[model samples]
Target: MSNATQTDRWTDSPRARWLAVAVYAVAMAWVESAVVLYLRTLTQRLDPATTTPLPPLERVTEAELVREAATLIMLGAVGWLAGRDRRTRAGYGLLAFGLWDIFYYVFLKPLTSWPRSLLDWDVLFLLPLPWWGPVAAPVSVALLMVLWGSLVTQLPPQRLQRSPPGLVWVLTALGVVLALYVFMADAIRVAPQGRQALQNLLPTRFNWLLFGCAWLLMATPVLHLLIQLTRRQPAQPTASQPE
Candidate 1:
């Protein structure tokens, strides 16, 4: 087949693209679930509410780092696979991430009905900030993921005219900072009371405002990129041009 024909054949095959997405989602889900199960086994002895004094910075475990690295690798691989074409891949990545997260909860519910409501507290991360929030928090994020995924997947391909990288990056960073602040606000307030009292501090209304702001900030880039991609154009000049 000619190169043009082969390229057209590949891009036109939506079935293949979607099948690949399914396989990737299942594989990644299995890996993630297994790792999480193992971690739970290891930390089973620790009480969720227990607040021990923070360990010395030097004493942090390699196991923790490895787990984090593994998780990133799994997520990154999905993006890498999908990003074969920038626009297509962004869509695929967004959809994959969003679906994976949503289904994680769906599958977990059968095993343990822990998050019975949107207000149930859950750990959102384990890094420096260690995000903690209600189920509604991540669900809201998943909704954004769906919006971003739809935009990326459904829009026509085009080169980014504006290249709003600086704006995008700034918004992304602000979002992360805001998320961290909101999650850790309770911990921060309780820090003055000493480590022993930290467990009693829960997220507050102000944190919810911060979370809302952060969520909107994070979504700005995706929305902007989508709008740019979907903007319509006037028809190009035909062979008969006004002279």
Candidate 2:
């Protein structure tokens, strides 16, 4: 079949859905990277380790925060459109987010050469609060998301397990809290002094031990599903052909 015909044939299949989502995320990541390059260049914060890092409160602006929230909404919308149900929708969202994040840094390296090393610190997000971490941290999470999302997307419904129970969810939430604490700990520490303190704060360290524990905790559901799928697989028959 021709390429176009083949695409049309599998357009609604999980494979096509994932492919289209990946393409869209890559293009969107370029746009995201370009926008950040412009902002950082304007603010002179591209280096990230300058005497003063990150823009001031006025320079960062409420408008920019709104834009971040909108970016998340756009990502979620793509997943919602791509999948037939909740599990697949979440899978596609995670896939898109992971690819977008990884490619953002990939594109940025050639454009700005800012993160000299994976250990370089950067302001990862600004939502209800600012999230800060080294380049390696989010990239690690993104890798996990990509792997988990791929499995969730490609597996048939019967092979998939249901969502975790309430206690598992509580643990997941705790994991999220721990990870966020690692990312935003500095900001939280300076919060008593207000926004200026936070803007001026530079992270001196990262809690790798806590982060590792949290990563494992967040992966609980994925581990459970994997075990379930493995147990369900049929055993191979021994070679015993008749004459």
Candidate 3:
């Protein structure tokens, strides 16, 4: 086979898959941004951190929450349809999420232009409680997700099979817990005040120090894998001697 034909075969399938996933994410992000813009405009929450929903539209929260949940399910379904194996499916899901989130912010710019800079504060989510943080925080994590996802999804079989150490997993969980705490600190503090308080809570400051540590801890496994790949020696293809 010619080099071009060989290069276009199975060897390139992962790249093709990655491109397709990215395309889906970007297209979905445009739609999500438009929907969010309309919702926020209606709620007068274009500035979610400080703007309380208009009194008449207060009930929109429940539907907004459901839409967020549905978006996640759609992203996950993209992974399920795109990959043949569990690991690849998971990787694609992560990739899709990271791309979608990052692009959501990107597309929202022209529609609203609210996040004037990276440090601008925003409400990240509305789950068990509200999540609040600077725009930079989630974007940083999203970039890491993209890196780790690309690595696992496109890597050779030998590298992909070598999972990170247990300690790495421990650090990952700890990091996630810490990050969540930081994001929800404001909401958690106001919980005793009642649901109305939660609805109107607005965080003015971010705990960057703690969040920075969490981000580093979360990065351990990805760094470890990268080191392994760099130090790995190429295989010698001698049948009998295995050299």
Candidate 4:
């Protein structure tokens, strides 16, 4: 079938949906960065590398944790609403998350001149524990999320573009575990002491070697997609677009 015919055959096209998702994610990121800016300004700890957690330590920490969880749900809900199936729903979630993260930093640039470089260390998350890593790590992972998500959503569901195998998922899970471990090792070590110990973490350096391995493993599905794409037959020319 012609490319136009194939695209038109779909009852609900992901291309149009992708645009909506992208706009939503970008706006969400702006709000997230603004919120962080306010919190940091309140704490007088605007530096990304600072060891300071939010003030009124216990209450603020609880609030921040809840906010982070709420953000995830909001992102996932948009994905759930946009997709036709479970797989595509997951794709939209990942895509929205990746866009939100990258743009969070983008929006932060003007609000605060923090993260002078990609290598700047950042306190990435605070759910079960404090997750710390360089800005580059999450950005790289976000790029991977975007790649895999686009493939899952935009690629035609045909033999030419099949779902990744079980092994790909296993490797991806392994990668996620490794990355989380790397991000939370400091906090984990201090857990024996108490919350006070975790609150005092500075995180002097990041384990790039381990994170690199994790990133490669996390890229399993993308690698599989590339292999499938290389074996695909060349695309037929389509009708020209209007001027």
The local distance difference test score of model 2 is 0.83
TM per prediction: 0.69, 0.89, 0.90, 0.89
TM-score of 3: 0.90
Off by over 4 Å in 1: 1-15, 34-65, 85-92, 159-162, 187-206, 239-243
Alpha-carbon shift of residue 165 in model 1 (angstroms) = 6.6
Let me know the TM-score candidate 4 reaches against the reference structure.
Answer: 0.89
Which tens-of-lDDT digit does each residue in 63-154 have in candidate 3?
A: 77888899899999998887778878878888999999899999998899877888888888888788999999999998888888788888
lDDT of residue 33 for candidate 3: 91
Residues 37-141 of candidate 2 have per-residue lDDT tens digits of: 988888877876666575675746677888888888988899899888888898899889999999999999998986888998888887777788889999988
As a whole number from 0 to 100, the lDDT of residue 60 in candidate 1 is: 43
User: What local distance difference test score does each model get?
Assistant: 0.62, 0.83, 0.85, 0.87
**95-185: candidate 1 lDDT, tens digit per residue:** 6766666666665554344456677666555564345777687777866775676555555454354245687769977996897788777
Better of 1 and 3 by lDDT: 3
**Shift in Å, residue 112, candidate 2:** 0.3
Question: Which structure among the candidates has the greatest TM-score?
Answer: 3
> RMSD to native for every prediction?
5.2, 3.9, 3.0, 6.1
Among these predictions, the greatest lDDT belongs to 4
Model 1 RMSD vs true structure: 5.2
| lDDT by residue for model 4 (153-234), tens | 8888763344568998999999999999999998898889977777777788788999999999999988988888779577
In terms of lDDT, model 3 sits at 0.85
How many steric overlaps does candidate 2 have? Answer: 0
Backbone clashes in model 1: 1
